[model samples]
Target chain A: MLTEKRNWGWHVLLILIVMAIMLPVLFMISNSFKTLQESYHAILQLIPAKPTFSNYLTLNKQINLLRMVSNTFLMAMIVTLGKVATGLLAAYAFQNFHFKGKRLVYFIFVATIFVPFTTVMIPNYLVIAKMNLLNNVIGVALPQMADATGIMLFIKAMGKIPASLTESAKVDGIPNRKIFMNLIIPLLKPSIISVGAIFFINSWNEYVWPTLVLKDKSSFTLPLALQNYISSEGGTNFPLAMALAVIMIVPPLLIYMIFQRYILNSISTSGLK
Target chain B: MLNNNSQIEEAVNSRYGPRASRKPRRRLLPFLYLLPSALLLLVFMIIPIGYTFYLSFFNWNLIAPTKEFVGLANYVNVFTDPTNQKVILNTLVYIVLLVILNFILPYFISLIVNFFIGKMKGPYKILFFIPSLFSLVVGAMLFSWILNPVSGPLALFLRDFGMKVPQWTNSGAMAIVVICLITNWKVFGYNFILLLTGLGAVPKNILDAAALDGVPKWRVIWNIVLPLNRGVAIYVFILTIVQGLQYVFTPINVITQGGPYYGSSNLLYHTYLNAFVLYKTGNASALATVTFVIFLILLFIEIKFVEGRHKDAD
Candidate 1:
């Protein structure tokens, strides 16, 4: 009975911490639906007196919010697909085949994980510009697709596959490509999904590179659009900005919800490794 | 028939290359498989880094026809400039605060979440981790609303309680603190999840024995669990430094613009300002090269200390 009481105490404490952490987010959502006056009201209110969709309407009318959403989604999907495919092929080769310079190649690939995009931003921009891809979504997505973290995670995941399974297939006259497709790819589903989800979230949230590369307002992703909106409007239009924030956050949140298990599993396993 | 049989045998032997000779060619297939990714990395990552290094010595505005080679002049300017000094100081403070908070707070939170959350761990983790899914720009904007002195909820609540709330964005030190808070809010969950996994890997038998021996819970964690989980702790430590430096760029650009007299600008943001905004590609490249060297040093240390330990244990 005493232990039960202590447990309840801890539960309440944990709940309070969680609430405090989530307050800004909750307030954003609540204020997003509030009238402009209520959103700017002096007193804090968790629930709006009268909820309205006017803010969302304003965002759509002003910023073409739907277009930005679709743009972000498309960029994220392309980047994720590219990263997954490249990461999988590279990981499979590293795990299955012995090459003379395998160690050196692996080192080069893994080293990029530490090389923050900031360090390479200027040169990458120049390269992109020279290629005439400036202000293009493809340009923004292309450089981001080659992710070191994705390769590392995939390699770790592939390492878990039993060597005997592939060896037996080989002995039975199965080719390497066929084994990768028929056997390894099937086993890699969870890691692939998790890695894909991670890449998608990352690309969706990416701000700095896209901001530099993409100059056209029409080519803007959600974060860039929201930033422009804030700078142009300043702080006066609180509800409208909050509404935009909601739109920017919802997709990644939904993705997280759907793939929470795989994401968490991958994170934990990667840490252990 | 005999001649035909010998010819077939010779063909098979030539093709197979006597097994030993086959090994060399077998190694080439992996290289073929690795070509696409390697090419991408070379073009995008490796070449860019080399270019960054090369640009550090040149006086170029990125569009100018001739980039005059001014070898090490940009590096000298980076060291001597006062604004760059402030940026470096701000970056150091940001990294220190981030490492401490990110390292300590998340560890404790993980402990609580791991030991105390019980069956509700999943729900709790999801709730805490929700903030991380938001883009840093969105988060900074959201907090800007929440921390707006005039119309913000916290200000109003404080006023009602006869307390004072500082103008968060206008002040320099306070802005940095606010930025740190928001960053911690968004980032803590990732490290928490990492530490929790580390704790989970602690040997159950040793923990049970510690409990039986009446070793206090804190002691068991500090002395037993922590020592055992050093690899993860170092990993989290390195991540805090790396991601912390990178994460501050978004908020500074979006919310502060290194505002209130450049209080929040770090080396990364400063580099952006130099290259894009100010069109001083030389200075920016120099700064980037310096920061890259710092990162390489940190990575080397991690490899030597953390990964080196793993090797020793094996």
Candidate 2:
């Protein structure tokens, strides 16, 4: 059809446009390797001339980057586990049960997705503080335990498991819990992993709630730690900030890369569905 | 009442049903599973919303031993205060700019990439989506440095031609614009993917059929593509305005903190400032309640719109 030759025009223009769109991210990676002097003076360079690892050292010294990374990882893990567990149980109930007031209960859980965090930020902070969870990772993770999105995603996932499989298991006198554990759980592995990735990334990038609770630098998540570099005084140290930025982006980026297809596909399909 | 109902049910089960004896416990199992998520939803979400309302009626500095009930005075303050007036206006501006940058921009970009381009949409999508995964804190820092008027890369490039970069962070309106730009960069690709995938659902032969009849490309898109993809379009439109409020918060915090005399502050950030920094608990709650009402109204509007579109299609 000669479509390949005609497509050359489209490819050339898109390549240039995408490069412009991607320049900031490219700069973010490149500038992390530069000295403070070159970062300021050689501003447009896509690659650093004299690269150094000193920025990483300074980042560690200034804020103990490793500690923040661990704190964030722990917090996200707890939150993701909590969401997935609750979501699985709830989704199983919704999928299998014909309980009274099920519609009301489903709406109650699913509707929270529409409730903006800002409207409830103050009360959530007060509640966390009252639990004596100030300056704690658990404080950041607790209120986020039951996510409605995970419930919605899981319900859609469970709908795909053929009903006859569960029905025959029930006929054999198998309890619902065992059926869930053995049959549904293994079948729902892909959904769990993709949903887990979404929850983990959301929790990892969470800044507002963590900023409210984790005031101590030692307890801060990576996004909150960047706040130290963002204030007027800390903005002067460009290279270290870039280094910290690079460090802060890596875990979520890695998760995203590894789970990219499943993640994007499920998000789009679930939203449209 | 509970004892009477169960006693009656036990009598019925004894009389008629050995299998029915297990029905009560079976009904109870689902509730037991539903309890944990429901309890969390109550504590973290439902109860907090109610608490926000209760606090809105009382004046508290959060340091004091007692809260004095003022009853609607805090709501009055949110409405009467000049700073809050500016913040409410700023919130409206944010909705507009966010819709433009996040929704409309991605709409056109998705159209171009899907209709005009031929191959390897996946790779381009991945490149754009790569930014969406990172923290907006990173985006805030990235844009602040790149658009820095003086030593930033953009400034340095423009200076070679004796051009000067605009000092965006210098003013309140410009600060808000810059914040919107930063979020657009972070959010654009995801929305692009959504719309493109939605567009991909339109039958290719319909477009080709229209084209063979000498119909313009825009006609085919408007008549065929847009009608089919309205679901994703509406989802993205509301999402842009709703989630956009929160997305702009990080940039506002990292860049402006609602500074230059509450110039760039929107309703959400203003509420945060009132609660935490100023410690005006009642005032913040009032603002929070107002923001909630606004969001509810937006949801109501969307429901209405979706129904109306459904009727027209029918």
Candidate 3:
């Protein structure tokens, strides 16, 4: 009887914590549907008294929300593809082949994770400027494409494949490239999916670098666009800013919902290994 | 069949001069496979890091035609500046708070959820992790809206409860605390899930045995569950440090711009302010170098301590 009572108490506590965690997200979505007056005055209400689409409509008129979303999508896709390709090639080399300085090279690549991007932000900006890629989405995406975490995760996944599978193919006179493409690539579907999703979400959500590189309004990614909107116009336009925030969040949230299992798996597997 | 195959392989190898003919081409193949990533990393990561180090010794505005070398003056300036000192203190506080909230709190939360919430674990996890799904800028914006004095739900709730909600942004220490709170809210679920995975690996039989031996639940957790998952704990620690720098960047930029008086700014934000806002490339590079060295030491410790134990266990 005492244990049952204690269990119920724990349940109540957990539910309360969950509500606190969900509160901001719920508030943002709720306010996005409110009118300016309702948002300002009905702040304590969970649901808007009179829900309206005016905030979103106003946002559409003031800024190119569609363009910003598309820009983010394009940059994310390109960067994800680049990182996956580079990660796969490097992982295959590290796992399948034996070469001098292999250990040193792998160590160096892994060590890059420790060097936070902020440390090299200035120099990278200079390089991008020199190449005349400033204000270009390509410049915003290029520096971030070389990801150490993606490569390391791919290496870990590749290590799990049995050596005999590759060796038997080699003995049958299959070319290395063919083996990698026809045999190994198919086996690595799960890792590819998880890693690609991570890359996509990360690139989609990237802010500081894009903010630094892209100055043109047309070139603004979603996060940058949202930041500009909020800082300049968000004071009086709370509902509209909330709407932009909702738009900015939807893609990543969708991806997260769909791939939560893979993401969690990837984190644990990479960390524990 | 095995003997015949071995004889055939020996004959082929002998004809090819003990594998040398095939080995030379294959030796280059690995490098070919590695070249793309290596070149990109060299250009983007390795070379830039070296250049950042080089730039730290000179004084230059990025647009200037000439950069004058000043040796360690930039480093001295970083150390002596009062504003920079506050930034350093903010960063240290952020890291310490993150270790408590992000690492320690999540570990315990995972344990409770795993232990008590039997069937609701999946749904609870998804709910908790929802905040992290949003982009950092979006998350910060949402919090800023919620913390707005006039229109924020938080203020309204506090007012209803007859409590005063302070002006979070205008206050220096409170601003940093609020940013940390927002960060922890967004991130704790991620670490919780990671810790749950770690906890799942703890042997059930041992727990049962401990229970059978009359070991208290707290004792079982403190002695067995924690020690068994030290690897994950250490990983969580290192991640907190690394991410502490990155995570606060967005919030500070969006919400506070590093201050009512530079109280919320950390090393990363300071680097940005120096480089972009002030156009002091050299000073920014010097600060970056210092931050880089500090993390390098932390990373080295992680490798030596945590990863070393991991390998031994494997």
Pick by lDDT: which candidate is best? 2
Q: Each prediction's Cα lDDT score?
A: 0.82, 0.84, 0.83
- How far is A174's C-alpha from truth in model 3 (Å)? 0.8
The residue-by-residue lDDT of candidate 1 on B91-170, one tens digit each, is: 88988889877788888878876655556688877787778788888777867776777666777778878886776677
Using DockQ as the measure, the top candidate is 1
lDDT of 3 at B283: 94
lDDT of 2 by residue, B1-314 (tens): 54685586668778878486668779798987788888888888998889998899999986788999998999998889999999999999999999998999888878878887677788888887877888999888988887778778788888989998887766899899999998998898888888888788777898888888988777888888898888778878887888899889999999889867888899999999988999999999999999988888777766666666667556
The DockQ scores of all candidates, in the order shown, are: 0.63, 0.58, 0.61
RMSD of each: 4.6, 4.3, 4.8
Candidate 3 local lDDT, residue B181: 80
Between candidates 1 and 2, which one is better according to DockQ? Answer: 1
**Candidate 2, after superposition: displacement of residue B43 in Å?**
0.5
Which stretches of model 3 miss by more than 4 angstroms?
A1-5, A232-236, B1-21, B311-314
Which is better, 2 or 3, measured by TM-score? 3
Model 1 agreement with the true structure over A202-246: per-residue lDDT tens digits: 899989778988899888998898787565124557788788888
lDDT of 3 by residue, B1-314 (tens): 54684476567778886556467768888998888789888888899999999999999988899999999999999889999888888888889888888898888888888765566688777777777667777777777777777666777778878876677777778888888887888788778877888888888899889888988888999998888888777877898879867888988888889988887889999999999999999999999999999989988888876766677567
Docking class of 2: medium
DockQ of 3: 0.61
